[model samples]
Target: MQTSVIISTYNSPLWLQKVLWGYFAQDRHDFELVIADDGSSDETREMLAAMAPNSPVPIAHVWQPDEGFQKCRILNKAIAVAQGERILLTDGDCVPRRDFVEVHTRLAQPDRFLTGGYFKLPPNVSKALTQDDIAGQQAFNAFWLMRHGLPFTSKLLKVVATSPFDEWLNRLSPARPTWNGHSASCLRSQAIQINGFNEDMQYGGLDVEFGLRLRHVGIEPRHIRYSAIALHLHHGHGYVTQGMKERSHGVKENTRHNRLTWAERGLSQWLDSSNRATLLRDDRLTRF
Candidate 1:
């Protein structure tokens, strides 16, 4: 099935460029790239315009006005426009491995969503990475990362290890495999059934809320943290605030108590004819 890789981004054009380069190097070429921009400056739009023409796969930009940390809103907008049956959601700062898309495609199930993990890089390593490193696939190498000042840790082994041991560990880990926005995939129809993410949420725990809603609707989360890996670029969480946390917590609590299967303010709001006409008139929404 065709996949739509939805990447969320703000103002980090440099990191986004590196992430796109990683997508350009994907071993699987059947997926399309969709940027669910959370109101970035002109720099990001210009960068996308310049790169869209030469991209290996189709590129689309779905953006909204800069309202502080409205990721859920923009993501719903992207989902409204995505054309693929399977939707892979990630961040623009997370660089996927060559086999990332291939693994997700191979493991996709009708009654489930895939939850993956990321090997977080230090700020130094993230700053040092270049498009050439991503294109050559050296950015995913454990030795290469170590040489670039990554501290030696067991988690770093994810970069190079693809053994059955790793798979076993993924399955055995106590951490509940929730749908991480940094690296996750689900059927587009399934996402639609849940009516997309809760727009009431902010930065913290928004992904967890979406995952919980999916489960409320009977879509199991399959753990693929070992196989479908991505490298998360280091960045400050300046957008996260106590107010945002409280709001997100409130939403999660409501979902837990109510067992909410659908978001009240979600993709359907944006998919309506009025919003579509407005988006069509807006120069910001570009499809390639």
Candidate 2:
């Protein structure tokens, strides 16, 4: 089946370039790339425009004004024009492995949704050199394996080797990945039929909520462990200190599409907001 990969990008031009190149290097060439430029201020759009004409696959860009960091809006918008049975979604800052698309295609099934893998740096990454995205990915991968390998393998790895619904999953197979679905790909219709992502989110918590929603909707997840690796360019610390915390404990600074409402409605709306940058400082809007 034809696959359409949806990338929601902001100001990460360099990372986006690598991701596109990786996708181009894929063994399979039957996919299209759809990107939603959530109003980037950098040379990202220009770079994408210049590169699209000569790209190995069909490249399309849907750009909007500098709204807040509304990833859901862009994803929803891109999916409308996308033409593919399977949809792969990844962050612009992460570079997909050459086999990224191939592994998903081979394992794809009708009732099952794929929960690909991702590796993020430890909480201490902020103190270290988090500037290099690729470096960070490597560091995170090693750290990720050390911490959760046993539990992850015993609990969830088998799904990747064989679909649980498929009899083979019960055979002696390793566990699939548990933590990287943001970089994971899914069937286009499965994602949309579940209403895609919660458009109310901008960043951070969106993925977590999405996982919960997918489970509630009875979506069977196929995990990818060994294949579909990617190099994630560093973007510094996250908005929240820990995944559960609402506010960041570190110094507040200007981030790409940085806004005050990040903890509130999410960076999604703020990035697309007209006065998104200025209005975020408004204390009356704090939901947390």
Candidate 3:
């Protein structure tokens, strides 16, 4: 089945470029990349223009006007336009391993959404990484990360283990299989059926809330945290606020308590409204 990788990004063009390079080197190239841009400047568009031509897979830019952290809105817009049977969710600041897409594809199953984890890097290592590092897959190696400033930790096993060992670790992991935006995958139709992400949410538990809704509808979650890994690039969470996080948390609690299956302010709301987002299709960079 065709897959679409929906990545959310604000302005971080430099990090976004690194993330794209990781995808360009993916072992599997059947998926499309959709940039769910949340009101970034022309700099981001320019960067996408420069990178789109040489991309191994098709690239689509679904952008809305920047009006604060409307990640949920932009993501819903991207999902509406995505042309894939399955959708993999991620961020612009996270670089994937070469096997990232392959692992997600191999693990996808009906009525189940896959949730993975990311190994976060410090600011120095994040900035120090080059396209070559990601393309060569050294950026994902625990030894390489440690040599470059990441302190050794038992968690390094996430990237160090392979095959049967990784599978065993994944099954043994206690981390809940939630809809993490950093690394997650589900059927596009299932996402649409749940009405996509809640547009009222900011950051915080928004992803988890979406996962709760999916569960309410009988869709199960599966852990792939050890197998499908992403190297999360360091970036400031200046957009986060105590109030917003608390509000997002409250919404999540409501979803869980009420067994909500559809987002009140999600995809369908955007589609029914007059507001529309711009789409960059093919190599033309033309608005659609």
Query: For each candidate, what TM-score against the reference?
Result: 0.95, 0.63, 0.94
Task: Give one digit per residue, the lDDT tens place, for model 3 in 59-163.
Answer: 888787778898998898888777788999999999999999999999899889999999888999999899899999888888889899999999898888899
> In angstroms, how far off is 261's CA in candidate 3?
0.4
- What is the TM-score ranking, best to worst? 1, 3, 2
Between candidates 1 and 3, the one scoring higher on TM-score is 1
lDDT order, best first, reads 1, 3, 2
Error of 3 at 31 (Å): 1.0
Where model 3 places Cα greater than 4 Å from the true spot, the runs are: 272-288
Ten contiguous residues with the weakest lDDT in model 1: 274-283
**Residue 54 of candidate 2: its Cα lDDT?**
59
After the best TM-score superposition of candidate 2, give how far the Cα of residue 90 lies from its true spot, in angstroms.
Answer: 0.5
The TM-score measured for candidate 2 stands at: 0.63
User: Tens-digit lDDT track for model 1 on 1-288?
Assistant: 399999999999999999998999999889899999988999998998898887889999988888688899888888888889899999999999889999999989999899989999999999999988988989988889999999898897577767686688678767798999988999988888898999988877889999999999899898888888799999998878898898789998899799999888877776765334234344267887
lDDT of 1 at 5: 95
lDDT of each: 0.87, 0.55, 0.87
